[model samples]
Target chain A: MVVIAHPAIAEDSMPRATLRAILGMRLQRWPGETPVKVFVLADETPEHATFSKSVLQVFPQQLRMAWDRQVFSGQGQYPEVIASTQEMLARVASTPGAIGYVKASEVTPNVRVLKIR
Target chain B: MCVCSRFAKTTASIALAGCLLSWHTASHALDLLDGDFQLHGFASLTLVSTTDNNLFGQSDNQISKDFSEVGVNASWRLTPALQLSGGLLSRRAGGTDDGGVRLDYGLLDWAPMSSEGGRAGIRMGRIKTAYGLYNTTRDVPFTRPSIILPQSIYFERTRNLTVSADGAEVYVERFGEGGTLSASFAYGQPQTDTEAAKVPLVGLDRPGKLDSKLAPDLQILYEGAGNSYRLAFTALRLDLKYQPGYRDILQAGRFRLTPLIFSAQYNAENWSLTSEYALRRTSISDFGPYFYNGTFNGQSYYVQGTYRLTPQWEALLRYDAFYADQNDRDGKDFAAATRLPGFTRFAKDWTVGLRFDVTPQFMLRAEAHFVDGTGFLAAQDNPNPQALRRYWDNFMLQASFRF
Candidate 1:
């Protein structure tokens, strides 16, 4: 869903915080590093681009391995897979501590848009 | 042992209660279970087969077979400051004896001091030995595709002692802007006899008579940006005092052995590389002049890369080489020897493979290895003058799951 970061971040900054947290930090500490967990946004939300960029920055190898393992083991449901940025923003706004990225034009008062470095 | 059993039972009972309460609440209310009772677990299954035309020069070389194994792991947060975790592994690769459940890891971690930026804790029980950068993280089957672990750093002899020490470890971690720094100190008597017999060699030798003295081990690790590193050192000293018939052996010997290991890894978008080197030295007092006393050095290096062609498919390539002073001496057949004296040589392998990530939790990997063997040990023992080839090849496919 639509992802948002603190307003302190610049609009043109890279959307890399989520990527850094998932790849650079170990899983045990991931929850403490960010204010929100990642989720899919409703298609109506404006913050789709930021969420897409965050996903793009993640190490593909780690993501593939983690998802493949989780899906095969039948332990739990996979994270909600979304196809559009508007949907991501919609979900992020409704969900607390929910973070995702959207296009700069979609930025609104409902959620804080963070700058990616 | 009784206390440990009671502790396990009590923990299980508590977990069951938490699960029941959560189920009732979820059925009647909108809230999920108390987030404090965190439940996490993972499971994996693998199948392997090998084909050989000539079994390492044996008369009957044609052999092929397939086998599978399953592993399950669970961890529970008993409280804000305490946690309990354990794993069970079962395999049918070798025979009936090889297909039994074993406790992979079981320990209680207590964080006496913890905050958003840092934590200090002590863990006790059957803790995994933190001897290298990978040891603590090696249990997750999905972390690597290969069925066989890197042999150079984690030798075959060391597996039996993979989990050791009825002791405690104190660890501290600090989070910085770029990454984290973590360090730990551990001391205690190893729980199993396996760690003791292999003393000088780590886990190189089969169990024999055991020396029941307390052994000490220490390790530290650091991770930053795209790199992770580790340094470890362990020492053991034994006095052979029991056998009166071998009084001379007692006087001829006090043994001290130490092994040092250093490793680093860098992960990138489509490739990851890891390398490690280790050195071991042994000294004995009172052994006769003919006793071969020298440092047995072994070194191994490997680099691996992966490319994602699509969301469901990927390719991998790797090369590894290992060399050890088999003779414990510099020169060829330098003869004078003591302790487990043998020859020295090197082995190398180059591998290429592909993996299909069919789903988030399942993957199938296929790889082929071309191996070259060298050194005095590669020479044939046969009196015949015919030359023997010093190379071989093998192929393997594995499918695994982690949850």
Candidate 2:
């Protein structure tokens, strides 16, 4: 899976910790203070699990638990769950400050691929 | 009493309907202000039955629907560094808690410092107390491992005093390759005026009032390997003063409680293991000769394991134990002195349960507990001491929904 972001974002690469914070729903804004809108596939999907495990280096359950703790406690919100990689691509391509993951083969020019160092 | 019951019945029906409806539809958080403002909520209903003693109402040999939880919360990120959030809850927990709309938490959180490494923040207002792992969101059914939390440390009788407090908290967190670390310190006034809070401490309503000084609570936690392992420690202290009532037999007195807790957990791909241990020191003074005036150390712990048979189904097993006074683990001396049952002061419980996620938004669970004592029974629910039983079994079923 490749991390995809809006084409408008300035940085083409990010630290893995910063990526984790973004997907963990902790980092609420980007460098320019653009509210970061996170998107993901349903937890039960293979793409979602692979992205969470191999890409983000966290378990899908961990992400779910974290989101539950934050959402229920009024600390944060859940990432918008997309139905498919096609939808994930479209959402990331259209939404400014949006971040998501899709299969490497499915990456399109409309979205920017973020390299995790 | 009649009014309360009617209200409970009404909400129960509505919550039941809500759960049923949720199974057929997919839901998400309601977003406004360009998704910066969000609203979310959950509702749950539980049915409980016991063998030999009343619990969460008169559930002896009959099912009682006296336990339920419903809540709604909203948060707005006024700016990246500032957020305003609040939650409203209506919880029904038998004789201990009436289903009344109450503010669960309302706070303003400010984080002026942030970086790739970590961030620091301060929260002010009525904030949820960070006790053990689960205290912060114990009311949310979807977050609990069982229908009822471990009674040993998370006692329902005095939950009002430990659930939330009005004050301020400062927190710092760090994110590194090794793991994530966070710590928080809070100074707040716990609610002590409720009957639920008083009955557990004084053993009766006593017609007097209980007031508490500002309490201090601290917790530090670390999550390693992406939450594959988690460890935490917590310390809390409360000091309370009691005023005698009209023609009261007791004199003005003071009470102090200090508790230290250790928690650890390991999460695997398909299974998880968790445990917590607590030491509590309590003392009462100036209450005159009739009441107990000395200090006693209490102990409680629990170990639990959960396995996911499939993504949609899970199973649980746990052993929980509590000793009101470690020195009197069996309560023999106290029983002889007060003429109460020896087993009333301690409890050991074994539990097993199953959960089925019918959908992401709806869940169903069933659990059974074999308890060896009535240590945590609410005095208000079982007013007569003689009616208490040493050995009992409890069964519970719950349906929960969230959006």
Candidate 3:
């Protein structure tokens, strides 16, 4: 899996924990005050499961519960869910401060690959 | 009196439904204000049955369905540095709650400092108290581990006092390479109008009401190992006064409660373990001979484990214990003096529960408990303390839905 970010993000790499925080909805903004939009495929998808375990190092269900608890409690919000990998790539590439992951072969020049620090 | 409260609850439910129905149209307009505006809600119904004692209704030898919860919340992110959020909640828990539409929280969050390293913010309004891991979302069943929270620390009898407070809070967060660290401090007036709050603070039949002054609540949390390990510490202090009524047996009283809690959890793919310990120092004074006006140190703790039987199924086991007075764990001295049952001052509970997620938006849960005391029982549900038994069994099932 390849982690991708919007073109405007200056840093090409971030700690694994930072990446998890963004996807977990704990960190909401980038350095420039741009809202960090997150995109992901359905939980049941193999690509999504693999990304959640390998990159985020968190269970798929745990992530879902975290989002549910935060959103319902008025403490935080949920990350935007993209239906498929194609949409994930397309949207992340277009939206500023957006971040997502996809198959290595699906990587396009529109988005920059983020290296795990 | 019972039928009257039930009728009022039904009317309130209808009113809540009406608000939700109208929000369907307003939901679209919310986006017009700002694309970031979001509206969310949830509802749940629970059935309870017990071998002895009434819980949430006439649960003794009968299934009681008076337990239900509903809530609606909205948030607008005006900017990265500022946001406005609020929610309304209605809870029906046997006779303890009246099922009225209550404002849960309405707050404005302002963040003046922000960077990749961390951020600092201040919130003013009705802010939810951060007492422990589950206090913030205790009313939301979908976020809870079981139908009922661990009564050891999150006692239902005094929920109004610890649920939420109206005032201001300041918070700071630091995002580090190792983990994330955050802390918050709040000073506010806790809600103390409910009978549930008055019963524990003074007496069950007190004609007067209980009022709370500005209290301070502080909490700090640290998450490490990519969010697998979590730790938290919380300190809460409350000061309350009693306003007497005509010919009331209880005189004007005052109370001070300071509780400190330590929480920890470790999460893995297939299973999780969590435990929390609390030390409570409570002092009551100024009441005449009608009540026990002394200071006592109480203790409570619980250990729980959850296993993922499958992707859609989960199982949980927990041991929760509570002692109203740590030094008087058996309550023998107090029982002999006050003529109350010794077992009433402490509780030992063993629970096993199961959860099934029918879909992302719906869930079903079942749990059973074998309790050895009446310490945590709601006083309103069991008005005649003399009829209480020392041992009891409780079983509950709940179905919840969320948007």
Candidate 4:
């Protein structure tokens, strides 16, 4: 279970509206962009593996070409990776704009946990 | 030098012998207590070629015929919280004997506080600069596909020796149901060698001289992600002064605010895009001794979009532009000074490219650039004024691999 978020942004304060806005920017989605979802890896693995799997689950076929398109077009970067669950929770607790998930028990006073489904 | 070479050869031979012995020993039996404390090393060779006619204003022939570099990276994990690592580089451009080596990352990490999801650790030794969002991750082989980094943002050198300081840092992170945040702080003497006086050349040219002094610097960074968005900010401060070789130089011991960058990217199944804008204030101190200081304010920005056509192929396009205040010399703005070589001070570029991912760790990329030069070059006092305009088209291809 990773612990993450800004030191100040409390979990409850991040309403759906704020979460949407923050994630929209982090995810680089336009105002009326289509519905898209994100996920977090609970177990520890290589950072690249986590990124590849998360992205693959969302857009399986696009995974082959999406990274290159992003690099050349400068649309944005792939998702970031953390070393451990504790690191994830700490990052979420201190970062107001960050959204990551860990084990249910890891939830702290700093960040919110959003369900993928 | 002879002794050093001899020593290196002997060390290599010893290492080879040790490897053979280890192979034989392992084949005989699985001895739990037979593990020996041994030193090991690894090396890499890179070959690069460019088809662009002229790059960054150097003569077409000045391009590297076939740029090759050899380097050794070694590491020893002494304990769960302690390790030693270093690297050395030598390239054909400079003879093998002209290579340089330095401690890459050697530190004692003490994680006094630990939890399933969080830990606070202190690391000391030769620490790398964690300046911007990408600085810490820049050296990873898989980070980017190009041989040339975004020069505008990162200096290509492997080590800023002057800035690599002996110091300690504290890091804290928290991961919640939604996102994560992490923060760190460090203090140390600059690593690169500096001099009190130096001549700054333009473009990729090396400076004629350098100052010798170690200045302390401070940096702060923040990154976060929500259900749909991510945000990051990096700030740095350094103490220094700038004096052009010729002109009424502006000198001040102040922190030059290089720029504050804001970047965001959205991910979707079929498509995604990213945009970044950075604004920096140019003071007299920035235009050191190479050329005259003219218009002192400048800003640069770029936006790009990407669409995945298929699993193996993708397309991309981007527009980048930068502008500077017109040269103000002797109370006269050089905006209209066509007769003077130093009158221009603005520039812009546009680029498009494609990528083919052959595998997860390998990719081929090609990009073309169309650039316009407004004030990039100083005018030559030639009879024909039309000769002052400069422009060029550039093309690049790169095959990158990582493990």
Candidate 5:
């Protein structure tokens, strides 16, 4: 799985820690003051597990706990959940400052693949 | 009678609204400001029973359904750097809390400095206290590790003083490759005017009023390896003053509590381990000759483990212990001085629980606890101290849903 972002995001690559924070919903804005919009597939999805473990190097449960702690405490919000990789691609492509994940083979021209350093 | 009916009406209406919204597939809706506005809520009910002592109600012999929580919150991200959020909670915990609706948290979170590397922010208004790990979200069933948190640290009787405060907090975080380190400091007036808060501190609902000075709380946390390892330290102080009522035998008294807590957790695939230890110093003085006055250092600690048997099922085991005074672990001195049972000063509990995730939005849980003492039982639930037992057993079943 590879992380993808809206083509409008200026940075093609970001530090892995920053990427993790973004996906965890702790980081709310991208550089240049663009509101960061994160999308994710359902927790049970294999793609979601792969993206959380391999790409973000965190367990899905950890991510869920982090979101719950923040969301319930009114410190942050949950990411918009996409139904499938198809919807994930479409959302990331259309939504400014959007970030999501897609299989390497399914990468399309609509969304820009983000590289983790 | 009129106010009671009005409250019932409001609760029924909100519950109806929540049920209607639960039917919507998407939890987030009304995305008014380009999806900046969001609403969420949760409802949970529990059935509790105990062999000897009442908890959250008269649960000594039969099941009691007096424990429930309902909450709703809304947030609007007005700008990338600023957001406003608030929530209302209606909690019923038998005589301690009468299911009254109250503001859980309402804060304007502003991050003047923000970037991928880190962010520093200030929250002003009614902000949740960052106590231990679970205190901030303790009311939310889904966020808790068990149906009832370890009473050793999160005292339900004194919860109002620690749950949230009316004031401001400043926080800073650094997102690094090795881990995430964050720290916060808050100064606020704790909620001490409630009957629930009064009973715990003074041992009864005194006619006098209890007021707290501005309390200061501080916490530092480190999350390592994607939260595989978590550690935290917290320090807090609460100073309270009581003014006696008309013809009141008690003089204007002073009570002070200072607690230092250390918490750690290790989360691994399929299983997790967590523990917290606290040292609390309590002092009460100047209640004329009518009340006991002294200083004591209390000790509390708990170790808990949870294992996931399946993707949808989880199991938990925990050993929690508490002592009202470390020097009098068995309460011998206290019992001799007051003629109260020594068991009231200490508790040792063994708990086992199971959780089933029926759906992403719904969950069911059951737990059983065998307790050796009544140290943590709320006086409001069991006003008669002589009725308490040295040992008891408790069982609880809960159903919770959120959207």
Candidate 6:
């Protein structure tokens, strides 16, 4: 798995905690204080499960429940879920402050790969 | 009776309208706001039937459709460190609530200190109480494990008092590779003066109303092993005063309640186990000679399990118990003094339920309950405690939608 972020993000690397917070929607802004827009594959997808377990080290359903609790309680919003890795890559590359993950083989040139600090 | 059903129909129609509105808004609401803003809402309509006493209306042998819940909430990230949020909620649960729209929560959250290691913040306004694992989002159907929450701890009879309070809260969170630790402290005035709050705190026939003092609540939560294991502790103190009306048979009295709760949960891919234990200390004094004046400790707990049959389907089983007085667990002594049935002092309930997520935005659920004792039933619904049956069963169905 390769973690990629829009170029607007200040850090070229991130700690796992910060990454979890961002993916968990607890942290809304990047280091530069720019709004952080998160994108992800559908929860049921193999890519989503793989990325959540390996990169985020969390269960996909846990993330979904967290999102549901937040969204229904008006405390947070759900990350935009894409249907395919192609769409995930395309959106992460185009959208500012976007962050997502893809298979290492599918990593493209448009997005910056973030190192795990 | 006909009028109540007519009103129920009206609320159901409003819920349907809310459903359509949320669907429309979910797709476009974010685009309309600054990139930092979002809109979300949910609606649920429940049909309940009971083998005995009424619950959410005349549920005795007849399907009662009066239970409905609808809410809309919005949040805006005004800045990277500050956010503003609010919600409007309308609940129609038989005679307990009026089904009128009320401000659920309106608050400004400011994080003065934040980092990758830990963060601290304050929220000011009407804030939801951090009672247990589920109190903050208790009104939302999707967030709840069953159509109705475990009544042992989340007592609907006294719900208004703990639902939301108008005041301020401070929260701190620490993030680590091992787990996340979070704590919050809140001081606010509970929403009293409602029948739901009054009937349980005071007597159903009280001549006066209940007024609350500033309540203090504190809770700590730990999520370990990548959110698979959770533990929590909560403590809350409430003080209420009864103001008698002119020439009233009752005298002004004071009641104080302090509750401590211990909660734990274990989550796996296919199944989850959850449980919470609460000890409540209650004191009543200065009600002249006609009322019961004493202090006692109450106990409540529930053990529940949920299994995912598939991605879209789930099953739930729970056994919940409540005792009004720990010392008088059987209630015989209290019953002799008060002339109330001993069964009124305790309740044990067994529940089985199923849920189906028709889609990401909509869901359906059905639940059946076998209950013994009348401890948790609302006095307003029972009217005469002597008339309540010691054993009863209930069946309910609900459809909920959210965006």
Q: Against the true two-chain complex, what DockQ does each candidate achieve?
A: 0.12, 0.63, 0.54, 0.05, 0.77, 0.57
lDDT of 1 at B253: 34
Tens digit per residue, CA lDDT, model 2, A2-29: 9999999988988887788788877777
Per-residue lDDT tens digits for candidate 4, residues B230-276, read 44554443333432233334332222334555656565654556555
Q: Clash number for model 4? A: 91
Output the better candidate (2/5) by lDDT: 5
For every model in order, the fraction of real contacts preserved is 0.03, 0.42, 0.42, 0.03, 0.62, 0.40
Complex DockQ, candidate 3: 0.54
Off by over 4 Å in 3: B1-5, B11-35
Interface RMSD of 4: 14.1
Ranking by DockQ: 5, 2, 6, 3, 1, 4
**Clash pairs detected, candidate 2:** none
Q: What TM-score against the true chain A does chain A of each candidate get?
A: 0.49, 0.98, 0.95, 0.47, 0.97, 0.95
Candidate 6 per-residue C-alpha lDDT over A73-116 given as tens digits, one digit per residue, 9 for 90 to 100: 55667787777888988988898889999999998888999987
**Span of ten consecutive residues with least summed lDDT in model 3 chain B:** B26-35
User: Model 1 has how many clashing residue pairs?
Assistant: 48
lDDT of 1 by residue, B108-212 (tens): 777666544566788877666665544543545555645444555554333444444556777786655455566777665553343223332311222234343
RMSD of each: 9.1, 2.3, 2.3, 12.3, 1.8, 2.2
Pairs with backbone N, CA or C atoms under 3 Å apart (clashes), candidate 3: B56-B94
Candidate 2 lDDT (Cα, whole model)?
A: 0.87
lDDT of 5 by residue, B1-403 (tens): 5348545844774575477475545544545566688778888889999999899988999998888888888888888789899988888887788777889999999998889898899999999998998999999999999999999999887898899999999999999999899999999989998989888877785789899999999999999989999999999999999988888888999999999999999999899999999999999999877787899999999999999999999999999999999999999998998888999999999999999999988999999999999999999889999999999999999999888
Against the true structure, what is each candidate's TM-score?
A: 0.64, 0.95, 0.95, 0.55, 0.97, 0.95
Candidate 5 residue B115 C-alpha distance from true site, Å: 1.5
Docking class for candidate 4? incorrect
Interface RMSD for each of the candidates: 7.2, 1.4, 2.0, 14.1, 0.9, 1.8
Interface RMSD, Å, model 5? 0.9
Cα distance off (Å), candidate 1, residue A13 = 15
lDDT, candidate 2, B203-224, per-residue tens: 7759788999999999999988
Angstrom error at residue B314, model 1: 3.4
